[model samples]
Target chain A: MSEWWTYRPSSFLLFSARTYYRLFELYNAEIWPWQVLALLVGVAILVLLRKPGTWQGRTISALLAASWLWVAWAYLYSRYASINWMATYFAAAFALEALLLIVLGVGHGLVWRPPAAWISRAGIGLATFAVALQPLIGPLVGRSWSQVEVFAVAPDPTVVGTLGVLVLASGWPKWLLLPIPILWCLVSGATAWVMQSPDAALMPAAAALVIVAGGGSVLSRMAPARDASGTPALD
Target chain B: MDEIIKAPPLSRRRLLGALVATGAAAAVGPRISAAQPDAIITRPIPSTDEKLPAVGLGSWITFNVGYDDVARASCAEVMRDFFEAGGRLIDSSPMYGSSQATIGYGLYTLGKPPALFSADKVWTSPGSRGPPQIEVSRKQWNVPRFDLLQVHNLLAWKEHLPTLFAMKASGQLRYVGITTSEGRRHRDFEQIMRTQPLDFVQVSYNVLDREAEARILPLAQERGMAVIINRPFRQGALIDRVARHPLPSWAGEIGCVSWAQLLLKFIIAHPAVTCAIPATTRPAHARENVGAARGPLPDKVMRQRIESLVEQL
Candidate 1:
């Protein structure tokens, strides 16, 4: 880890931020009108989670998987890895996360009844933060518009929000879903720290929030069954 | 690695004169060659009779400052320090974000210094990307043409080599070279060196990472290829570790007043090494790095001792 730590902070940050800026500009120019569709889809997921309609889990997971796949192909593999070699591994992990989400939710046709617990409430807040508030972190911090990292369009917040939404899944596979977001946050945080970036605190902060909230939700879900029947809930 | 610079600006000329009057360049004491005064050392290019300075500035991360005005201004000052201290070779790549553009900006701030021996790299290609990337690189550097055009990390090199040769053959460039700053490609880099008709090669070579010493440096010598050493301070870690302690008593034998100069002098001392490009953003650090080019370089015996001393630290 120290060996990776040996790099000059600017080297990693410049490659990352520059690649991000380029992809952002390209995405903005080419997909100017279509971005509204992605935003509307994001709003639909939030509305579905708020009121458990038919196949709501399936819908949210499908949207989450699509976002992951898009960023994996468009940003990580196609753009970021061209400069930083580590992004190739990240792209693979993201693609795998997308497939897992699709199989677990879309394949099974699970219904998402939004949890009534405080942890799930907090998870909703986090998902909202990633979608609506995360993009503003860049502009509010004084970065140029070209350098803005938008959720669904950018890898970091897309993964962050996905983790928040997944934590609300009552019976979903938490183990399979948590690692990629956690790992990505660590990598992203280290990279930001190196770059002297304003968002340095955001990634590690997201990782910590995911661990506490995701783990708490899973624990809370297990506790009710174990207390009543003297058996672990997942089995 | 040689820095091609003009006569100093008036303010820096006064600073140089004052340093000379104080019996050293900056705070470095004594003289290895008093007659030469502050004249920077240069080594032959091997392929050509032209001499390159022993020290040059690298533009990997430090010079890739995008559009940040404060960072860009700092880069300009660093470039000024480098040229004023007799630097010439300013190396960059298309892979390094805005590095080529920043180098152009730094030089532009300095009135497009004549001492500039612009060196750049082509990082993309299916063969067609080479021409356009070079065109972009040329505009970024704001130079009519670069002194050297290198294949970056050997990516699509087979595809781009022909274009490089054609560029050189057509006088768009003076030298055609290949560069690999990663340890993973040392074997292939050596293979290319032995077989390719190259004028120069850049590689990661430093005190802590002596992997290049076994084969790459020797191959460059046997092949008469000019060598440019990167990561001489292991991308700032090695020197930062050594900088924690005071300089050793015998450090002055090669006239190193700082750990930066000591680390730099060690690399450039290798007779096969034509230049060592250490990137920096601070004008003070740039001046310190250029100091290694002055006075004397360490010989083989001293290089070993320098290695041993640094290891002990």
Candidate 2:
């Protein structure tokens, strides 16, 4: 019990950094041609978000759900759990996020409706950065491109990209979805910062962009949840 | 063994060479430390006549510095101080992040001592994952085998303990044990200790928490399983608590100078304890921790007096 309090925050951050750095190599080796499939899926989501017919919206949500499940199984349950036991809880959280995304985003027909405001523009920009620009971040910071972070593959960028889209979406109660993404960002950012990696800035910067784009305000105005009729849902 | 310190800066080849010649070769069973003339007081493993230094080092969060170069170097220095002070039995768990790796690095840099007892834990689920976790831990620790492999916190022990026993039978490891610190799972731990074919058992024991004294310690003594006492200073809480009050006037009677020594001396004083691993990141504190290993240990009367003083404080 006393040992629990004796932990220095740096110890945790340090563990996070080391874990992430190792993951970069492990993931890249594990997913190669699949990377092409993921990239195409990411591109498809963006294209669908631009036009967002009912089918397109459902397809985009389905794609995000698939990504979350993949990461949960591949990274958390199968790999990270071997190094740290707490990864089981992390996997559970990602699995929960996947289920929620399916229920709220797909079932409810939530779609990206990037408004013509700075916040929307910035939010879209963050979303784009998480998918496209974020991969280039490692190279710019002198990290090899081989270790580039990809959306739907890595936890950090996936959360960031999700936040950016949530903040910009026309959907109500995206506030309902902020907890997991926000938690993941804080977690990944702390890990990267402690490791002194370039990706450290990605999560925090995405978080700030979402807040500026009215993520929190929209969340505050929205109830914890809503029904099809737009009233707060009762248990 | 002396040739390690007398040798030049170690390369991977040199590390492997020293390992093949000294560390790995000499680690058949418990070997006495000649690094320091008066080896730290030791207790025997009842199953095997292996005598372990009563003071070991625990790699909890203190040694889990990930890949931070500076922090890793600090760990190496701590290990160096520990080695010079007649310490052995460096314990770690996979749950502690990069601690096993840090210990590997420290051992590589310091050149493994014959007295070095690499103790680590396999912490994962499902019996199948045990072998892989052990493999990873070995790679991280840069050793082919560990002296003692424990099931951390008794997670999946029934599933994992058999794997450990098989490994021990095959000579991949020397001893098998289970560890639960901070008094989390004593009932289960007691069951394992009482019934299982274990060589050692680690649990939280200090002047502050004497719950172990009532049963666990006595059971260990009776069953003849070597006991590794952890959380010796209550993770520095007891030390801080005692430091607030003056050191008892009878401090030197057990060769105590610092608060750390006082607390450690109390735990190591137990006849049941084969070792008390008090972890620290700083070299100076490591030195202070190892200091308790030397000189006269507190007798039973001294142990009671020290515990009472600490409880009052």
Residue B8 CA displacement from its true place in model 2, Å: 20
Return the DockQ of model 2.
0.11
Where is model 1 chain B poorest over a 10-residue stretch in terms of lDDT? B26-35
**lDDT of candidate 1 vs native?**
0.77
* Weakest 10 consecutive residues of candidate 1 chain A by summed lDDT: A1-10
Writing each residue's lDDT as its tens digit, candidate 1 over A44-127 gives 777877865447877888998998998898778876664465678899999999998898767765545434577777678878
For B97-132, candidate 1 gives per-residue lDDT tens digits of 767777888878899988798888888757678999
**True-vs-predicted CA distance for residue B14, candidate 1, Å:** 5.7
Q: Which pairs of residues clash in candidate 1, taking residues 3 or more apart in a chain or in different chains? A: B2-B52, B2-B53, B3-B87, B3-B88, B4-B88, B4-B115, B5-B115
Candidate number of the best lDDT: 1
* TM per candidate: 0.71, 0.62
**Residue pairs in clash, model 2:** none
